[model samples]
Target: MAVRKIEHVGVMVSNMEASIAFYRDVLGLELQGTIGHPDEAIKLAFMGAPGANETQVELVEGYNGGLPAEGKVHHIAFTVDDLESEIARIEKLGVTFIDPAITTLPNGARYRFFYGPDGEWLELFEPPAK
Candidate 1:
């Protein structure tokens, strides 16, 4: 079978409220909803852009210990039309950029990384226009 698109990325968080606020209020993603799994003692919050159908960021709660030191997964990246404007908007929310400036890949794509409320790494990527 051929691979399609990414469905979602699951992130284990210590505080669901803070995670939700960072992804929704600070990052401007909409909270689709939350699911409670009593058996697993977990709560899942799905978030994405308005009108987006694929690739959601799922915030997970009810796990023990703090955020992972380093997971197999590195960071979740979102594509944006205007990286500068997006960075400015997020900066206004008090999010600091990991890089001093936007980094350009050899292929000409631009990207930047930052930490979420729970110290989860996230990225903003912009591909060169066609």
Candidate 2:
């Protein structure tokens, strides 16, 4: 079966309010809404850009054992049309990215990684046009 685009990236956060603010204020993503899983003792907050498709950043809180040194998940990526322009814009917003230059994949896609508020890795990917 062919897989579709990524629906969302799950992130475990210690503080829902702070995580929500970081995504909403710092990254400028809209707060889609939040839900709680009583059985799991966790709350999920969804955030994404306005008019975006199903893609989202899912911030999770109330999890046990607190935050891990490194989350179980490595990183989450968002697709962009122009990698350079996007990097430049994000850099102006004071986001320091790890890779000084974008790395090209064998499939001709380009990518770079950066850290989120809670030290979670974030990525920007640009695939070759069809």
Q: Where does the lowest 10-residue lDDT sum fall in candidate 1?
A: 1-10
Q: Evaluate residue 48 in candidate 1 and report its C-alpha lDDT on the 0 to 100 scale.
A: 92
lDDT of 2 at 28: 93
Best by lDDT: 1
Best by TM-score: 2
Model 2 lowest lDDT segment of ten: 1-10
lDDT values for all models: 0.73, 0.73
For model 1, residues 69-110, the per-residue Cα lDDT tens digits are 666344576777788888888989899677788877544667
What is candidate 1's CA lDDT for residue 113? Answer: 82
Off by over 4 Å in 1: 38-40, 72-130
lDDT of 1: 0.73
What RMSD does each model have against the real structure?
A: 13.4, 12.1
